[model samples]
Target: MKNVILTQEAPAAIGPYSQAIEANGMIYTSGQLPIDPATGEMPKDVEAQAEQSLKNVFAILKEAGVDGSNVIKTTVFIKDMGDFPKINKVYETFFTESYPARSCVEVARLPKDALVEIEVIASNNKTNIK
Candidate 1:
């Protein structure tokens, strides 16, 4: 069975998509923009933007009953490659040992002109404390 995940802790989907979906013991999240769920605004710097984006991703994962350690893979999209290191620093705060495999790329643009966006895939077996 497939389950659609939704939570008020993260920014709502801007389009016709669920925040995440779970099936076959795996949870897949939609790319999360830096928009704050309460303010509907993005932070100014790459570090803050990265943090917010990952927070949104984490919220969805939490709603699906998993955590960062359960994640097996991730994909990040950024408006600029120059912000990679800054974003990576924030990324480290969210994930620990046995980090999930990830692919990050610089893109020409992003929805709402967000500086960073992140999505993840996680197993539903266990949760990790952040």
Candidate 2:
């Protein structure tokens, strides 16, 4: 069975999509923008934006009963390649020494003109919950 994941700790989906979905021992998260769920506002810089985006992704994962270490892959979308270093710095703070595989690309734009967006795929293999 597929389980939809939702959390108020992250911004609600603005369209026809769940925050994440779990099926077959895997949790797949939708792209998370930097919008703060409390204020519904995007942060001003790439570093902060990346932090918020990852936090949102983490929240969704937690709601699915997983964590960053469970993640196998991630995709990062940024408004500028110039901000890659800054974003990477923030990204590293989230995962451990064994990092997940990642893909990052410069995008023309993002929802709410966010500086960064992140999505993750994580394994539920350890807990075998649902």
User: Candidate 2's error at 76, in angstroms?
Assistant: 0.3
TM-score of 1: 0.95
lDDT of 1: 0.91
Q: Once all C-alphas are superposed, what RMSD does model 1 give against the true structure?
A: 2.0
TM-score between model 2 and native:
0.95
Which whole-number lDDT from 0 to 100 does residue 66 have in model 1?
A: 80
lDDT of each: 0.91, 0.90
Residues 1-130 of candidate 1: C-alpha lDDT, one tens digit per residue: 9999999999989999999999998999999999889999899999999999999999898888787889999999999998899999999999889899999999999999889999998998875622
Candidate 2 global CA lDDT score? 0.90
For candidate 2, lDDT tens digit of each residue in 1-130?
9999999999999999999999998899999999899999888988988999999999998888778878999999999999999998899899877789999999998888888899999998765322
Candidate 1 colliding pairs, count: 0
